[model samples]
Target: MEQMTATGVSPKEVRQRADDAGMSILRLDPLNTWSRVWLPDNMDDAYIATVDTRQDRVFALCAELGCRSISLNATFPRGSMSIEAIIEDYAKICAASAFDLDCSLEFIPLWGGRPLAMAWQIVQGAGASNGGLVFDTRHFVRGKSDLADLRTIPGDKIHCVQLNDGPLVLPDGVTTKDDRYDRKFPGDRQFPNVEIVRILSETGGLNQVGAEVFSPMLKDMSAKHVDFARLSGRGAQDSHGNVRKDLFFTRTGSHRPLRFGDGTIHPCLWS
Candidate 1:
């Protein structure tokens, strides 16, 4: 679950809520506050102190909630920092949290991390055992990530796989920011989600798979009204018309086998 989902609520309360609902939080999405401010230009003594404090709070919350991983992204604009500097900062962050949990860096085409390979480079450069990558299919498709580079990453380096689909080619006048909020379900076939999933599975990186749809259409609907079962059902269908019953939406602690079009079954933990 996204940590922002429990904004203004205490970590204890958040854990209690999840316990009541029979769900476990596998990880938190995008440790937002600290990442946004952790830039090359802002690394002064005061800023470092502030960042440390924030990290303490976030780590404490994760420990309280029993979440073992947290996703992070570098959304800073291009030229704000060099790739080397970004790698250094990410390494420090990962090393700092290595004792507690995993810190996965997500690559965004519009931001510093792009094309999947560079994200892997940062993770590899970090050299922290707990440092990993968050493989989001939408960004992979939209950014035109190289398949060859995707194959090079080992299974353990990939911490999470966020599954969603979008058009292979963006429509006219639609900026990436505009397209980001409007994404299709996993089995839409508009994006090559299957091929990417297949590659990740072959490399043994399909540990955690979750449907992360950010659509304007879903904004007005309440959580209970959203049909997760339908989402899981569509996600279970493959290009060859094969459907797998094991690929249902489930919370943490409940394991499920996700079967892709290639007829390979991988143990998956849904977030």
Candidate 2:
């Protein structure tokens, strides 16, 4: 989110581009809902500013674009906030929004939402009708979560799905920071990308599949946009079973490496 805003592109420009290209914004990001209620005692004023700015601007932009889905992950590290406090904060945010949008909690293994189970717990406790999960393949695998557990979740509660592949083994002495920038394209490694797509299909309620590739290598390429679209299409075709690969190309919000029908691409979605 910090870097996203630093792209020097205005929200109004993004809005106009999406409108011009006939794209529909389906989600917003890391809205810093926590800033609305509380933050860890250790966070500094800069962190507060980043949180508030991302939230306020994204919220207003979503309203302008009619994007009703917001994706949130942990702003700080795990144990920075208690489960009870997080749920309470989420409930407050949801209530304050007057249920205008659907919100999903994305679990990142090394981040605050360290595992899938804990994220599910927060959603269950919050008990907000519009509350749900944003399942990302990298997070799911990194957290060492069971794919079978996904069956337990009501498909209707799955607000979004992201697909990506990573190395079969993490690099020695690697941190989450290292893991993030070193991702491989889908099926370029050992991730069960096809199975995940099939499972989400069976689970139902899928509106689109997000192709998220957060590679620093890709960022340096002059033709990275073209690569993202080509890889997204290849990945989707390789992964899609009975599901149509075209479903993955539909307009959405706040997902990475998102390719539009007219060839515009959203590079990365980081917060």
Candidate 3:
């Protein structure tokens, strides 16, 4: 589940809520805040200390919740920061989390780390065994990431797969910012979710798959109005049950069914 869901709640309360709901939080989102790691200001001593405090808080929560991974955004600001510096920071973050959980980099298009290759480069350069990637289908399509590059990634490096769909070709005047807010459920459009899933399955990166819809329509609805089971059912149907067959095993070697539409905005897999 995304950590944002527990915004104002205490870690103990969050865990109790999940327990009451019969849910296990396998991963958390956005290890850092909106401040990009590449920004010069964020590199200051004070900001670095702030970041350390945040990480400590997040790590403490992860330990409390038994969450195994955290999604780290590799957002790049307007000005340039050397790739080496970015990598060093990533390595530091990964190293800090390595003893407890994985640090997966999420690549966003029109922001930074769009193409799969660049995100892979940072992870590779970090050289931390727990460093990994979050494969969001919408970002993958909009980013125009090469399937060849996707094929080259080791399965273990892919920490999560956020499944969502959108137009294969955007209409005129539709910027990525606008388009991102209008995402469709997986298999609702021409997005190549199945093909991507098949490739990830073959490559062994199909560990954790979940729906990540960010539509205004979904946002306006109350929890009771949404039919999570139907949504997950459709995703499985669209994939022809390949998702069920290729479902991932947890670190403890136990198979847990992928529950895409768990009512959480982002349902993740721990493995």
Candidate 4:
């Protein structure tokens, strides 16, 4: 809370800044929860405060913030909850949102929705019109899911995509945290990022593309934050001062990935 207010920045201030720059904000995140994973052991109180906030409260916050989407994911192992029960609960959460909003599910190899197939199953079973899946490239590569799995999904059902890369080699006894920190810039490695984008392109579901490169080493760099002016022109020089234009556009039209400071990435549906 102190950090949020230290710069005297509220959501209103953020919106005003975007307005001043003639840019539109699409999504606000670090807001919603993963349903079952809200109360992991030794979690921070601040995170719990946000995660434990009811769906209705979050909906109200998003409504006031003028963003209609929130980041959501599934729990790992799932403990005792059946998939049916999870879907039922998910539907109720969406129904209680009070506003028409998109609810996207991001699946990770460490979580119950490790595979896109399973995430899609839950979203479909939930039967919520606004429910969809978030296809993150690193997760896709980590899960070892076939690209064909994505090909079958309807373009509209894929709400957004996170574009990133994974290392060609995996360390012994790797873990989820390792997966998070091991992410590479798109095309910086041999993760077939271009092919992933190509598959998404064929599906016509490339509404929002985000470049989320997470690296502990990069975080330690002095130039960790992205420069918006440089980003808008073509490519943003990363912390390592490398030109990363390939992450933004393909053979497709000029598109930009919203690379938030602190190495986070969230992409909203582009009009």
Candidate models: Cα lDDT each = 0.67, 0.65, 0.68, 0.62
Per-residue C-alpha lDDT of model 1 across residues 5-76, encoded as one tens digit per residue:
446677777899889977677786556343444443323566434334366666776888888988786666
Q: Which stretches of candidate 3 lie over 4 Å from their true place?
A: 1-8, 33-53, 219-227, 230-243, 246-271
Top candidate (lDDT): 3
lDDT of 4 by residue, 29-128 (tens): 5433646544444335774564565566567667666776776766445354677777876787767666788888777766566677877888889888
Sort all candidates by TM-score, best to worst. 4, 3, 1, 2
TM-scores of all models? 0.75, 0.74, 0.75, 0.75
Name the regions of candidate 4 deviating beyond 4 angstroms.
1-8, 31-38, 41-52, 220-225, 228-271
lDDT of 2 by residue, 120-163 (tens): 88888989988888888898888887777776777777787776
How large is the C-alpha RMSD of every model relative to the true structure?
7.8, 6.8, 8.0, 7.3
In order of listing, the candidates' clash counts read: 0, 2, 0, 0
Report the lDDT tens digits of candidate 3 across residue range 1-271. Answer: 3334447667767788889976677887767542335433324576444334367777877887778888887656523556777788888888777347899998877566667888899899989989899999888888888888999999889988887777898999988767877877666676777677778878777666667777777656565436543343433432322244434222111111233333222222121
Off by over 4 Å in 1: 1-8, 32-53, 219-271
Judging by lDDT, tell me the better candidate of 1 and 2: 1
Q: List the residue pairs that clash in candidate 4.
A: none
Candidate 3 lDDT for residue 236: 42
TM-score for candidate 4, residues paired by index = 0.75
